[model samples]
Target: MSEPEIRLQAWETHIEEFGTQQYGLSFDTLIKAVGKGPRAAHKLARRLKKSGRAHVVRIDYGSPGPWRNSKNFDEPGAAPHGPLWMFADRQIAWGYLEFDPGEWHPKASTAAHLTAVTELRLALTGLDTDPQVWTSERLLRRRLKTESGLAGIHIHDAWFQDFADPDKVWAVEVELSRKFGDGRLTRSLSAALEAAERNDLCGVLYFVRGDGLRRAVEGAATRLAHQRNLDRLPNLEIHDLDATLARKGVR
Candidate 1:
């Protein structure tokens, strides 16, 4: 792993270490450990979640954090410009919010959890094979880019290390997301492409949920994934939300 990637990995491991002792955390508490502000906190949180070592909860505690006289937890950023908390590992760890009760619901709990499992498992490499499972009503969270008061949710899943098709990693992101005008989905695809051009491990796979993006991104991703596999990584692939999930089970 590169220096930055190494550091990123270490930080996630740290969260897992601490998270094991606790159960969940508010953004404020995490700020102390990962640093303050949405970007920094988000960066760390995304890595933890993507790395499969943690689970993140977007808590709505009114406009500003500190949630003076708080009420209840809800969807992450459900009300905009709200504090989101990172909960680690199967509701067994904490990211920072150690005091507040995490937002809880039943409607999509099963699918949501399966989604988490599907996502985190992506980080696995080598012979970590377990039969793919089935899930429904799940969504692959999108990574946030550009600064905004209303930030898009950031999600991290897995990155594969490859050299034969350095740009192959880019295909993963390309395979995800059926549509997002103005390269919203393309940016990630580009990042992977750049990695492959450098001959780095292009094992990373991207999974985008929703339609339109499917034809657009997948059309390009499939061809690239096929070509890259021919060049190297015969077993690797760049798949959209459904295919990737189907490979695992539900989709």
Candidate 2:
């Protein structure tokens, strides 16, 4: 392939890989994924848009409501803030088109979480042992329905296979807020750990926002450890999300 073709192919792959998982990709996220400066990334996005492979969703962060197409900003009360790229009909025909922006609008927090997860996935590329493949929660849930022997398993936010070792897989959970109010967190963690063991995952990696959340997870792990044999349990690692993102220049 020619140089330009190669670059375009990489952009398309990145868009399909990340967009299918998160429903859409924020402008900044795309820029990071493509490893290009803003101007270059903008050009690439324009080319994709022109080819009818993608469309831009204008988001009004202040309004915290449904996103509209970039061409629909003339409507009354419309306040465009940022652009989110989604697959167009041409691209959607390739499959993995489970999300429909018109039918289901994501809450502001939900959108932010999805962006964070995408950013984390991009940041992993900077590591020595990056992820070879990433499976989002949406895909995991879909698999549970069709794949046998996956019943009664709790799905994590995402799962990734190690680039260095194809057999090594990890379950990722991104927690931005406290979800342990009524023993719910413990139960969720227990299920995830059990699922890891059953699926032969290397371990569970929890990316939590605050120290309090990290401590809560640690407390839960300690309790689980007491209940089960520690030597036989899979590894559980709690990381500070802010620190991790900062280290990767994502913050």
Candidate 3:
């Protein structure tokens, strides 16, 4: 196989070879490192997609700068559950919950989701595992401006892209909490499920605060999952904060 083909194979093998499905391999890096022609590289990508050996997802490398909010959203502890500005800002910092402006006080359980993702990453870090967690933050923002324009708009916390290969990519949106934050977990999961199905995402994962809310959110996520006829895109998974973190060894 050619060098580009080798690179593609390496990337697709990342999950089993590394830990995260996220492949930070630069396109430029490949051009210089692998003495493959442009046509060869493109062909390799096409083959990867056709073979289901890998997939692609938009990535957002958020710019670095302090967050700005007209209503002092940047103010500390503004959100009742967490910081409302987490999503408002262009960057994805450390936070469990991300505020959503679409619905009345909507929030996504990023804490549980990220905790699970990080756990999986940590567990497979040393040996042979590689499942990448990619961000389409930048692309999403640019899209906001291109589509939504200069005017302020509600931001969707973070768009997590799951790409196993060029043909097996998925987008995951997390919904957490039933009361106070966000409109309704059921509705939130529904929207995510809808979007994921439209795109190539495997499915949505709903992480509730506790098992008490599990049935409600899971039912919602599962129903949405089935309605879209997507059994894989948005796999409904509920996570309890305390227990999930403890199990993952995050203190």
Candidate 4:
């Protein structure tokens, strides 16, 4: 068994590595990474908090609607009902709003970002079984020469593949409300293809916020597929975010 300090250091290091990239860390995810029992983990978390090493953020989802604030919290152990443990220093700097316990909700919250954290939690769960997970934030920066100029691309929200093996990894992009034009779609498809061809990824996964967004993304995927050839399009998997949130029992 790892010593308490060692375990705590693992938590800190994990936060420094990944928590700084995405939105923040979840309580459950933090515990899993620490490899400690829940109660022990909670105690460690409290210690981290007391020591100013971490913070447990409370996320409250507003009613569902078109506005970014309308997003729902559906992941298991997600807040208003539970707490999200994040590194104190990494929270606001990583795009998550500052933790204000008195406030009902954070100043900013997005379905796509939250979904990324949830997906990351799912990835952490599978660590014991085998595959190593890497998010877009963790990916090595690669300079890809586009027709216009050299575009530096790195950091995907979450990657589904083993780090040690050469197996094709899946790059995921969570889209809640952002609109993409044809040109952007073409560039995205081209980038994915380039990444795949370079043996950096096996495919791409787009987690859209709703049915409407799904239609839009699918259209782009289809268009890109038609232009790039049938085989490349199959590599893109567009999924509905709500269903995933519900499946995870976030609500």
Alpha-carbon lDDT, every model: 0.42, 0.67, 0.39, 0.52
lDDT of 1 by residue, 81-162 (tens): 4445566564433233232234432222232333333343332221122111211111111112222223343232333333
TM match of model 4 to true structure: 0.55
Per-residue lDDT of candidate 2, residues 1-251 (tens digit): 63353235754655555665555677777677666676666676677666555665555455443544444223466655655544444345245444332433444557667777777876665322222377767667666546755556687777887778988889888887777467878888888877887778999988988899888888888778877867434588888988988898877
Rank list by lDDT: 2, 4, 1, 3
Highest TM-score scorer: 2
- List, residue by residue over 25-102, the lDDT tens digit for candidate 4: 555555654555567656666666655555555444553333222122234543343344455554434333222222
Error of 3 at 143 (Å): 4.1
Model 4 steric clash pairs: 74-250, 74-251, 75-250, 76-250, 136-155, 136-156, 137-155
Error of 2 at 148 (Å): 3.4
As for lDDT, the candidate ahead, 1 or 4, is 4
TM-score of each model, in listed order: 0.33, 0.73, 0.38, 0.55
RMSD of each: 15.2, 5.9, 16.5, 9.4
Give the alpha carbon lDDT tens digit for every residue of 1-251 in model 3: 63443344664333222211222222222232233654544454445444444342222233232323323212354423221211111111111112222211112323333333433333223222322344333334445566646545433333443434544444433334454355465566656655555554565544445676766766665666666787633354456544654665432
- Off-target runs (Cα >4 Å) in candidate 4 are 1-23, 26-45, 55-85, 88-115, 123-131, 134-136, 139-151, 162-166, 180-182, 229-232, 248-251
User: What stretches of model 3 exceed 4 Å from their correct place?
Assistant: 1-132, 136-139, 143-156, 161-167, 179-183, 222-235
TM-score leaderboard ranking: 2, 4, 3, 1
Residue 159 C-alpha lDDT in model 4: 62
Q: On lDDT, who's better, 2 or 4? A: 2
